[model samples]
Target: MPENLTAEQWRSFVASRRTTRDFLPTPVPQELIDQLLTDAMTAPSWSNTRPYLVAVASGQARDRISTELLNRWDSAAKALAGGLWGKIKIFITRYGLPQSDYKVNRKYPAELKPRSARVGAELYGLLGIARDDHEARRAQWGRNYEFFGAPVSLFIFTHRGLGEYSVSDAGLMMQNLMLSAHAHGLGTCAQGATALWAKPIRDEFNIPKDYNLLCGIALGYPSDDKVNTFKADRLPIEKIKLLPKNA
Candidate 1:
């Protein structure tokens, strides 16, 4: 709770967060993101190994990724859809259910979500995009390639050699970044889309060779009320929680 702020203001600030897909074009100073990354590192880690690294892509670097990734996605879309120009085709059909499914299967590890459409929905919702507006939605997702036009990007990585426990540590670090981003009134989206393109992106950004890309964080100022409106899906508390022995 904030003693400097009323309880309402404190709660409102902490409660605000969204994986923003659209962003204003204005530049965020490097100092702010630097402070954010420093705060993010404060997140708890196993034995304090602190293996997290951030690779930022801004300006030209940001533009390159945006162009390439969108091009790749557009190519896949065309090939799967047989270059359809109009009408709302079912996602699976438009993308060739079998082939798209195979791509998902081959690309993602067991833990990552493989559905590109599902990821798109979460992103568009954060930006208040309407359903069936495929162009708008795709354009919004393209913003990720543009680093949400934030001028800074934070890539989360972990050592390939770490055990699940260390992976969990890295995850905690990601959460810290998300929470702190909310507190700072900055919008962010945790982009797993890059997971499939990790190697390409890693090389593209000149990331150190030892790091494996866990995910990408698209950071920036929201174009609208992204923080408040981007509600999350959650299960009931009872569905996910149970006391071990004190029932």
Candidate 2:
């Protein structure tokens, strides 16, 4: 345990940290951004490899990336409607389809599917969006590409050499970054959808070929919007814990 840090304080802080889906346009200070990055560097890495890279964008750069991503989302959403015409559109407009370095669209395992579905249902419920309202849902999902209106977007990349371990290391670093942001009274949302279209980000930054875009984090002040209040339920410890063989 770190000095001056108590267990209760740590637990409370962790529990208080929520996934902020709505953000204010207020920009986070550059110095504070630097501090958060520095703090995140302290996260544990596999064999001290620290095989992760981050691309930060703010102001005009962030807006440009958001624009490109939202455009792609619009196309992708149309393609999902499913028809010969949708297929032709994707084929003609290649940029509308996924140009991801890694696969982002994946089915959840049977055990985890319900949890994922419940969270989605609850979020939409809070937003007053009906489950079958595909248009509204697509719009809500589109918010991910816009960084939830955050002023800053940090694109995380993991070194392909280390494979899954590098991804794990990146996840740890993101947790550190998000927690640090929360501690500073800033909000952050780790966005998986941001990884769906990496071309927009790659166009803006000179990312290495060996580094695969894994995810993104939106960093800024949270808005007063009701969406920010949604919280996903966690499984109880007993549900997750495995019993001893003898028992």
- Give the CA lDDT, 0 to 100, for residue 41 in model 1: 86
What RMSD value applies to candidate 2? 1.2
What would the per-residue lDDT of candidate 1 be over residues 1-247, giving only the tens digit for each residue? Answer: 4468898876676666556756777776778777887878888887888875677777777667667666656655455445454223535344322221013235455544544446647756666789977677666545545665665566676665565665688788777877777778787878766554564466566666566777778887777744436566644778668788967
**Which ten contiguous residues of candidate 1 have the minimum total lDDT?**
96-105
Q: TM-score for every candidate vs. truth? A: 0.71, 0.96
- Estimate every model's Cα lDDT from 0 to 1: 0.64, 0.92
Return the clash pairs for model 1, or none. Answer: none
Kindly list the per-residue Cα lDDT of model 2 for residues 1-247, writing each as its tens digit. 9989999999999999999998999989999999999999999999999999999999888999999999988888888896888988798878688878898888999999998989989989999999889999999899998898899999999999999999999989899999999999999998889999888899999999999999999999999998888888978898889999999
**Model 2 weakest 10-residue run by lDDT:** 92-101
Off by over 4 Å in 2: none
